[model samples]
Target chain A: MAALCGHGAPIALLSPAYNEAVTIVQSVRSLLSLQYPAFEVIVINDGSKDATLDTLIEAFELKPVSRAYDLAVPCNEIRGVYASPRLPRLVVIDKVNGGKADALNAGINISRAPVLCSMDADSLLEPDSLLRAVRPFVEDPERVIAVGGTVRLANGCRVRDGRVVEIGLGRHPLALFQTVEYLRAFLMARLAWSRMGALTIISGAFGLFRREAVVRAGGYTRGTVGEDMELVVKLHRQMRREKRDYRIAYVPEPVCWTEAPESWRVLGRQRSRWHRGSLETFFRHWAMFLNPRYGRVGLIGFLNIFIVDVLGPVIEVLGYILIPVLWLLGILSVEYLLAFLALSFTFGITISVCSLALEEIQLRRYPKARDLALLTLAAIFENFGYRQINNLWRIRGLWQYLRGSESWGVMTRKGFRAG
Target chain B: MTGGLLGGLWTASLLMAASSVLFMTGLVIARLISEAGRARRRARREALVADMMSAMDGEADAARLKSEVREPRLVARALLELSTLIRGRELAAVTAALTQAGAEPALLRLMRSRNGEDQIAACEALGLFPSDKAAAALKTRLKRRTSMRVRIAAARALLQMGETPDLNDLLAAFDIGEVHAPLELSAILDEIARRATEAYLERLKSSRDAPALRAMMVGVLGRLGRYEALPVLLGAASDPEPSVRAAALSALGALGHPDAEPIIAAALDDPVPEVRAEACDAAGRTALAALAPRLAERLDDDEWLVRFRAASALLRLGEAGRETLDAAAGRASPRAMRTAQMVLAEAAA
Candidate 1:
């Protein structure tokens, strides 16, 4: 039974490529190289005008077929969910230009499997990522509704034979900031919440959900900036109301790595979209806030999501806005203002550093002394400017959400390769 | 103005802004370094533990397993898991590793745990692994050992062919509470309890365990259809604990002791509603129609829970409970009370 680690499951990967010509091949190759006994890769050319579809066809010998099945989520119109007979498992959904949500919905409806995982098209998975990702479901039935594997900063990490070989430091400052932020968020924030069984988001980049639960929750909502958060919240609402025992989960293993935005413009757009989606989810289920009928999920769970999480960035922005005024108005003396900022900065740095310590305590990542020193510096420096910039972007996101604006922007990738 | 009081003030203000700028630069630098190092070690740690399980037999091997391993808890777990895998004495190293890891206060607490699986493994690991290696480290827990799991394990180990001296250390670990506790170390505690079972029963004859023990007597005697222990059962009808009194009432009914009817009648007004409620259930169950009127009178009890229970009890008492229940549900009880309304509806239904 133990030897059959990668056996049993017939798997498929759906890479919804929108202007992912640079990453399409690498993503497909990673999926094809999975250690599973049998599996296929499906690259959905989500109406990218670029060489995304052509590159796949030329490289993997793709041929089009009629849309196979229809378990798609409701975001955009599906022109056709296509398939290639040569590599039948390597089907391509040639759909009309719908956003990511529609592309995923198309993939879901077309695919036939009890288990389906959704990942960002640019991201690359480890050889047995799917096998490890699906372990919990096989081991414990009914208790687990979704399983999320770990994602690391792909910025400086060396990709060798489609696997991360040596962990390298990146030269780009923006990419570096994202690495620390992702580490702190995943290692500290998500770990704690998942431990408490209040995991709200199963990251858009790398997360797996039980096919039936996703469909049962009416799939993903259309025209939402935060489709990930919205779909996860809807699942929580449906499960709690039906009084079902289920869990949205996270694993600590780094199963996938995607390109982080090296440019501030792309990073700002990502943060803005995340904030807008979070607000939409909370406001959509505002009724569950403090309602005891929902049990532990209602009061404790939703309250944490709403106040501590969704509204946190905005509150932080306000704190930033208030500090300057307080100093100018003499409500706060110069020394007092500096001290308060110092204390808050120190506190933020401490949490990151402690998270690094705890992660190391459980599973040490940076083996080299220089790597440890670099991570320590990153932990200390993360709280200052990057946090402020994030707050500003989140504020912008909140403003855009209130103004009813939606931006389905595309992110450029610097393809995964050997260091 | 040259580096004096006013100059100090100006320099301090300048430094504040500089600190903010420096802070921003620090954050950028940190991000740079963090991105440089992202590590992944797939499932290799579990395999390491599986290896340690059997290599733990020797003190040197145990020390090496303990010292060399990163996460002793996981290693110990892997050791146990490996022990399950192969049909051999391979887990010596694993238990040795666990005992070394278990020297920590938290793990020691786990070793002497009241919990089922966790404690058993910890106990077995501590005992099976060379005890001499962890003896000095465990010496501190001598007094606490008397608390539960240790005493049981100690008594069991003492019964084995031959073991080293340290009776005082073992005795200090034996002082424990008398209650039937559901502890993480319950089995170990119970095993220890077995060592003093004769003395415990002697103590029980004049102790608080007398009530729970007496209730057991009621169960035994009632099943035999004998009226013996009636005095004890009647005395327990007034016991402080409602659960004890309820047990007595149940026993009296099973025995068909007519002498308990008066005490059962008075107990219907017992302040602790459950006792009164259970007494009513036993009375009604035993064909005590004579007590039906008194039970029916409780239909309008102040505590709505009691009133609901009485209505439920009366419902089982047949048509004889109608007149009393009907009056309780009459216009005297306002529609504002939903409990009464529910009771009336349930009785009608």
Candidate 2:
């Protein structure tokens, strides 16, 4: 609806590109085709040694432009700014190599709109997703500070003209397992927290924010693997300190399709990095844990994170090793062992299945009956081996965090299928 | 030895897992069936609509097709969809068809439906049929304390019906103390400006107490290109609130009227950085060559954005402004020189 009228508030789509020469052109083209009346696409070329900047310049027919912007947030040096005379809404920024957080800050500083949509360069947003994601801000512009949309795996979906033409479950078992995992994480967990008014994290893949709010909160925190979650937590702390009433929303209808890691090594690295980021964000803001001053966000929100992420891995891994040894040594009874196995294994299968069922009943993104059945099987099969391997990865992440490992492991993607 | 309770618990857990699997399968099957049914209904509706359109063109029996369509809501939607594509005599023909099919009464009935979506759709559809009954029904719906969305829809319908609904009545529906004014309200204001600019200008004159609302109104007026509000906008440029002043300066910039040059020039020296930024933008938009020295002086401003805008504004000027920027590049402070050089490099490229 906002596409028809010029009255919609201006928004800036800020994407950080790093060595993504393969997908950069398609992603940028998709962004320019978003169904919004007033918006601009700001793609930050984050010092890629590859052909990211050159590919963009050649593809867009870009030329240097005299644009004025403030360094509202900290970022690296900018080599130059380029714009195309043909596509006026597109602007490219070439800056030195900084992490994703630094690149986002560079884009924020250069952005002129009051609202900003931060997304990854590899992700593809549905055409109407921006309008749907920005509805909360239009409705209550004062109180809503941020919003996140559902992130679906784009592994096996059909792509046409840089859009997901058909929704298909990825054939890879790893990708299928992640499809179920993401459904649980976004649909159940995020929605539950959002209803309590204590949503802590908006995924870095796709989130909308009030420019002034993010700028006042000191932009995205640099040198953190979990910059997205950290910035949201920092916003909560700042708003609570100032005694301001604000909301961090999660809208499930708007979908942003992203490529999930397919191989075991890459998946392990991703899981570990995610766990490390969670630990880093947790310890960094430990004072908010059970603190009354931050209200439900401190008491309920941090408690959930502390139990599920910070402590869940260590206990699960210990149970896996120690339980069998104890039973073999006659220190624990066989009945008790069977009970433990039933609770851990069967209960997990139950949760994953119900999550898949909920997705089918509600969203129906998986249209084919065969794909639905395959996903259902994946949900059940994941509990046996995949879930155990994931716990081990998270435990490794815990160890990495303890050892002060700050590396973002190399993540490789088989590029999307051409139209 | 452990009791049998542990054994029974394991058995129960296994049973629970199996049942949940079955439950998921059942739900999936039900959904598939429901989707199929929905597809069937959609196909039937499309066929019926096509038939009705042909009837309207006299290729088919109009009375028979109208009576054959059982779903009033479906028929009403079809007529409304057809209304957007035609004009004049065709629109009149569609209206006659809708009345002949008794769609107006059905729409009124839907307006009173309990479902919020039904009510909203009814309100929107009624906009196409401008009658006293539809207007009265929408006004009644607006008076009720409903959701903001429904109220906004009702108000929009009233406006579309060429009725000058009270601005205060709409404003009363929203909480006044909110920091950021709703964009939907701005959209409504834009709609009102199309038909009744005086109504918006009148509200602008009286809305000083609420700075956020005042700023929003100023923005709306500017976007609508209502040059008649130039006097009000110029006065607002010196308002007590910085946001209002910025909005006024921005509106003036958009207008680019020669009469507002003095105000724009004075705003370049405004106390607030944001106001000065807007003033710089206005200077560039108006292309006042005489303000080149003032613009050059702003190149040394402390704020990064101000300096950047100052340099940009200078480039918007002609040869004299370029000479001033070149001088700044040669002799100004490091910050000013850097900005000037960047702007000059870009212009050269």
Best by lDDT: 2
Candidate 1 backbone clash number: 25
- CAPRI class of candidate 2: acceptable
lDDT of 1 by residue, A53-120 (tens): 88887887765544324333564566644445555567777777777777777777666555677888
Candidate number of the best TM-score: 2
Q: Cα-based RMSD of the predictions, in order?
A: 17.2, 4.1
lDDT of model number 2: 0.83
Clash number for every model? 25, 0
Q: Give TM-scores of chain A for all candidates.
A: 0.91, 0.97
Off by over 4 Å in 1: A1-11, A66-68, A71-77, A81-88, B1-349
**What TM-score does prediction 1 earn?**
0.56
Task: Give lDDT tens digits, candidate 2, residues B1-349.
Answer: 3467776777779897889778877876876787798798787678766765664575555565556445556655665677677666656656566666666788888877787767777787787678999899888888888766777788888887789787766676654565555557777877776677877677777754366567777776678776798988998888887767888888887888878989989989988877898888888887888899999989989876678788888888888888999999999998889889877876786
* Error at B152, model 1, angstroms: 27
In model 1, the Cα lDDT at residue A156 comes to 77
- lDDT score of model 1? 0.61
